[model samples]
Target: MSKTKNSFNHFAWEYFEGLEKTQKGNTLIRKKGRLELICSYIGNEPISEIGSPRMLEVLLDIQANSLNKAGKPTDKAERCAGIASDVFIYAGARGFCSSNPAALIKSQLAKSSYGHRPAITHPKDFAKLLRAIETIVGDPNTINSLRLLALLFVRNGDLRRMRWADVELATGRWQLKPLKGQGKVNMVKDQVVPLPDQAVAILHKQQKINGHTEYVFFSQTAKKHQIISENTANKRLKDLGYQNIHCAHGFRATAKTLLQEQLKYPLVLVEMALGHTTKDPNGTAYGRFEYIDDRSDMMQKWADYLDALREGRDTTEFRADAQNKADSTAQLKALIDQLGEDKVLELLKNKD
Candidate 1:
């Protein structure tokens, strides 16, 4: 690792290039870069190396303080701690270190009030961005891959590594080798992400690629058996004037917002659809139990939601149990409570 790069960066290149043919490996490389930036405020050692309790505490302090330093209002430090916990657990499993500081860090996380805010892209703007993505990936070969992207709402890298034999068109499910596996995966851990009709359309397109290749989303410049580069989808989005408005990752964020805000699905369902591995501070791990039924239904609904948005339809109705609305109420309550009930009554009286 460069004195410059930190955390998971030490082995990121080896980690990334090793799986050149698989899209997930490529994304890990980019995510490592993000992790490296995050480490700039902490330290440069491999995360596995810093698993001692003392190191963990120091990391917690640094993370909490870094948010303050950024001049943004202090977020619930628990989320940052949660991210740290997942990182340590992941690093430790890889034999990078003996202990997990993130676990220790998580214990301390409970004491800090939830201050993190979920960053999301607005649905209307996201719709504009999707239009751009669809337009950019319109070539016969890339279009199926790109359309399937929004349908599954999986990470760009995972989508790129999709293989031909993985999909069962009649069943509408696409099998994916779990990207987040830390240890040698059991057959049980190999994932099969359910595909919606939107996702199915792409499968049909991919079938026409003409090459008897193993990969589903084959790019011309791909390495042996490899499909797309880690950055291709986002790079294409940039070309279409969308710029920073959307990214390959932004799709997940957009889905979260729309699922809860627009479609009114449960928070648990939204998180599951995104394949979130970490749990909330309240012990809500995303995929510990198979969410097959819940995720399948949610994904189909989500695909429909995106379809409506893309086509500019005005007739979709969200389920009544949506989490985004609940979140709004809670946020409003917080803001109003902070201002005091008396103030609210006064404002209400004035409005009349």
Candidate 2:
């Protein structure tokens, strides 16, 4: 039997070749590897003949023998399924395949326990982590990268690929096309990062070092780009005794939690500042500049709160401390009016 033009191997390669045109760096490599894995199982089989059950069986066989990047036994089956689904979708659009067999099979894969990215969410604990970062004695590029990571909380790839042209220190804004936004999904493609005073100062210091380079965190040893190694920030965290306690990507979770829970920022504004794609009530996606002014204020407040936390100062919930203090005063005055001034003073004295 001869393989057809639309055989799994030929069509999947066609799909991936198209993907390679749009993707770069490790992303392209990883997707290609996953496609190869799937093709290894059914390379010569007609893609149209590979139903959901057959796909599931091949994935299960791969799962049984492979380990994930974290060395987990779950393997790359889930990711392979995703890649296969993409290929089938591509093929279906051109009338090569009728349906995606790789879809709806992820739930049937082996149940595996994977840990969430470790992060420090508690304010006090996170404060300690910040202080520890300040004391880290190493390459200034790595140190400043970590500092900016805490303040910016963007994906590590975004930070590493940060360019001088995108950063406006005078206006304290970073405008860039986020790597994740390069997909077919309609998201906030151009993310506007409002830099705080502290972050601006760090960038100023970095300017003297990397101003001549393309990337803000320039590195001579980086093979993929002149930017710093992806592990630079996390490796420093590990050296600071935060091996599993925290990592570079943890800052996003930490900021997301504290910005809503501790800093008292509105979820929509916080999500916007974090470059997350959130839909409005009408199901329309918000643009990057939708709430620019409000997000700017939130970013500043978040930076100020982090400063307070690092200095071991009173890290009151952002924008709520003053109102809360005023409320307390009004309650005290009402009590004093209900009782007598002398009685209220006596009660206060007793409480003290």
Candidate 3:
């Protein structure tokens, strides 16, 4: 190892390499963008020379200077601080720094509530959006991709990077590779998403068009056989008059809300279906595959529920089904409490 301290830019490159080793598919692209911003602000200075104050200045500069595609001011201080904090921690671990100063002043960074992504949480509004997606005149690939995002509720990056090889139509499962920031550190396992019948049907149609290539949403215009751009789906949504109301990422939030609040699935099941990490009561993170069966069932029901909403069918039946299951569970618990587990099991077996 060189005794000379590494520059911030050098450290960032190494850190990004570390991210690439662990993360998959478009995960580190955002981090690399943030690193570019940091490097632009600080130049190629020695990592040890910049402490917490300088880190704070860099973050504030990013916040005040960043602009969105719409040419409006956007705040990225929180994101910048997060990246710097991680970089400093990596440097500290490698003996190039004494402490992660970015962590110390992270809380003091600028906080803004200006750029919240819009989502349709209401069932009726979501139904209208689904109708719009179905009827929209655009690239067929873009439309189908948008529908898949709404139905499956995976991250936009995950959807864009989907591979046909990862999809098992017969088994109704899509084996998702870990995106840049998903799952625990150093535990990069493929996430198995249980595809609903509707989602699988969409995939079958997509296969007819793009089956020759690896990506499900492959775009001929894009470089290196990559799928469509990240903004393609959202741009379509905006063109459909959902600007600031619903974007591609909004689909995930929309699904998360409706599944729990409307369909009454357990929070854990919903989170698992979305491939998010949730901790148990002891503060330990749940295993990635802890609730596969329940998640599968929940995803199928969610797809069915979306279909009902799209057709403007009465959704009360979904709520009724959920209530019936809850009631059955409660009654079973009561019976077990009264008659004992063995007696209850015997009674159940007799009834069977």
> Candidates' lDDT values, in order?
0.61, 0.86, 0.80
Assess every candidate by TM-score. 0.56, 0.85, 0.77
Would you give me the overall lDDT of model 1? 0.61
lDDT of 1 by residue, 1-352 (tens): 3533335554444443543545544345555554454455454665555655655565556545645543542433444454455565555677766665555555554343333332236777767766766665345656565566666767776787777777788987877755654343322235568788877776776777734787777766776545777767666766876555566666667777777777777776665556655456797544544678777777777777777777787625545454566788798798797998888778879999
**Tens digit per residue, CA lDDT, model 3, 308-339:** 99999988657526678778989999999999
State the lDDT of candidate 2 residue by residue for 1-352, as single tens digits.
Answer: 3346888887888888788787898889889899888888888898888899999899988888786567665648888999899888887898988989999799898766466889999988999999999898868998899999999899899999999999999999999988877764745677999898989999999999999999899988887688889888888999899998999989999999998888777788878877778888999888887888888878888889888988888876466355688799899999989998999999889999
Alpha carbon lDDT of residue 319, candidate 2? 61
**Model 3 misplaced stretches (Cα beyond 4 Å):** 1-27, 44-48, 66-75, 82-100, 112-115, 183-189, 320-352
Candidate No. with top lDDT: 2
Ranking by TM-score: 2, 3, 1
* Range of the 10 consecutive residues with the lowest summed lDDT in candidate 1: 110-119
